[model samples]
Target: MTVAPGPADHAELQRQLPGLGQAPGPVDAAVPAAHALLVHPRARQAIVLGGLNIGYELVRVRRRSIGMVVTAEGLSVRAPRWVGLGDIEAALQAKARWLLGKLGEQGERQRRLAAGRIDWVDGACLPYLGETLVLRLDPQQRGLALREAAAGDTPPGRRLLLGLPPQADAVQVRDAVQSWLMKEARRVFLERLAHYAPTLGVQVRRLALSSAQTRWGSASADGSIRLNWRLIHFSLATLDYVVVHELAHLRHMDHSPRFWDVVRDVLPDFDQARAALRDPVLPAFD
Candidate 1:
């Protein structure tokens, strides 16, 4: 899952627009055009900033200040009910540079994600544990078996010999792969959690797979852990960082310096692994 920047920081927004109460004025025409355009499906207002035509969604809320968010799609503005459109546009002009940068980053990130989407079919390839796993449809196989090639095979790595026939449809292949991946994810998670728990001196009471959209892993105060199964697609080192991070929470619930010290105690070079996990080009199962 590629995680884009969430929202414009309120402090940054405040700094950009020192005074939101300024009277509305005509948009400056002196700014040269860039021939860029961004539009939101629900946009109710439009503005030209830095020569980029932006159609943004405007939502009136009972707030004291205006908020701006640039997502993969486009921009959205939440403004106080008393604020007029002119004032909102003025606020936008004030933060145009920051907004445009975020929009460009998100747009490119989304493009990369789309390009990396998986195609469910015979001989299709997907990343598994930092290596490419080729899918092979073999009806004779029982369930899903991981088979290695004897020396030199055309498509290397390992074959996930699925039980489905060669004629299986895309949906069947996707579901079968997902089911197997979830089971394998649980088995691997348990082993890794046990491997690190004794060192961290934390007893994990329960573990479950999470399908959260925005979160990768979460730890509960009650000794329960929930990890995203999709993480199985990454390398073991990357997965261990998340495991160690959550376990460190057992001693200190907050991410204080002491919590980081606990994590570093186990994996001295956890930062490298953490950076790898942030790579946005993961295989999209959906």
Candidate 2:
């Protein structure tokens, strides 16, 4: 004889319960636990728990769209507005393993960088234009100057001399250096923008400094360009590359082959400069 399916068999219970021979009676006892199987239409390989469906989207373009955002408040899943909540949560849970792994890696990298000491005072070694620039404090010099030592230049040696009070604190020193660098950045950036504009057959209508957190530079379709002020920490060559990259955007906004072609036309080996731009140093502040 064949054994009949019980309440433990959820699928079988669901199938058989609806077809019981007796006429429908008033609800007697509550439905058994196994009878509850939630089916979400938008769910793809996602598990359903407590009536909530969770999943992940394979492709997303907007940066604001949340992939896996967890906070003390609760787990929140944001996707394109068109995506259903069930699908969003399901997608998140499906990629939970990968997302946790990436978060751990990022945390570790940040810890390493944080542990690395960054001296912001004079005599500290800092990266500038693909080379290291040693900071020198000279009370005699009246103002900031990028000094290139001559064949027999004296005691201070070859270095960028920053003139400040001997008793100035770190903030004062940092501020003074930044003020000078930004002044130079404005002048130099415009000069470079003008220098490369003609060759690329594009005109730069306006230039501005950007203090954006996530982007190095940006360009408007209307011939306006914005470069990160932090770029002052980089070498002149690297700075020029960024200028060219933004200027090129005047013609091609996307990083498509055509856009890169425009950039390459002006700075042939831009890849090196681009690579150098990724240095993980914070901007100095006074």
Candidate 3:
């Protein structure tokens, strides 16, 4: 998602995953309730949909319509304070298929991420600039350094030398590598900003590295941009698509046709890059 760094009125794009089907239809009482169970940690209400029992956390807010979000934890429903409990359940029932599909997809995504979690040990591997890099502990080194692949190396691939002893714990190694990645992200982002700003005819006021979980980048009306540091793991084309996407926001804050026109002007093949960005199973740092 791309957000505008300002008040609530500012526009932001919500990131949507593919294969999450369309909005569900109206509640069907005739549909037999299944016995499946999905419970949220702070759930206070339960609903039966498509024969499955789903426990979700309900939050009363100042919003007009009931909104549902499915995360790694499960479902959370937020509705207007004046909306009745029955109405809330009706909203959920109306969207039962979509909710259930999203919940299952979230669970599968979490499982894949856990399975791909990188172990911060010597010879542990992680993606860097769309390529795999193996970790190499070098206590005598000053800090993190990237070295070309050397023969006889265990992985025989690119190596990132960490200035830590062989006894260094996982926490130490993870922190050290993360620090290097952030610094490198800043450097690369700055260079790309310079490369694309002139083409888009915009001046970037500032750039910040963001650790946002859902957002890839955001651009404020003031020309400030924040890009997720994890993007450095992908190819440069994918990274540039995000950069141009935000820079174009400086010209047009909303994602109107004109805004995309500006982005398309700078990156003709941006659609491919955008699709490619979603295909990679990024290494789980945590």
- In TM-score terms, which candidate is top? 1
User: In candidate 3, what are the lDDT values of residues 118-236, reduced to their tens digit?
Assistant: 88888888878778899999899888899999778777679999989988999989988988999989999999999999999999999999998778999998889999999999889
Of candidates 3 and 2, the better by TM-score: 3
Off by over 4 Å in 2: 1-108, 115-117, 149-158, 283-286
In model 3, the clashing pairs are: 33-51, 34-51
Best by lDDT: 1
lDDT for residue 244 in candidate 3, whole number 0-100: 95
Off by over 4 Å in 3: 1-107, 277-281
Q: Rank the candidates by lDDT, best first.
A: 1, 3, 2
Q: lDDT of model 3 at residue 146?
A: 95
Whole-model alpha-carbon lDDT for candidate 2: 0.61
Better of 1 and 3 by TM-score: 1
| Prediction 3 TM-score vs. true | 0.65
CA error at residue 117 for candidate 3, angstroms: 1.5
Q: Total clashing residue pairs per candidate? A: 0, 12, 2
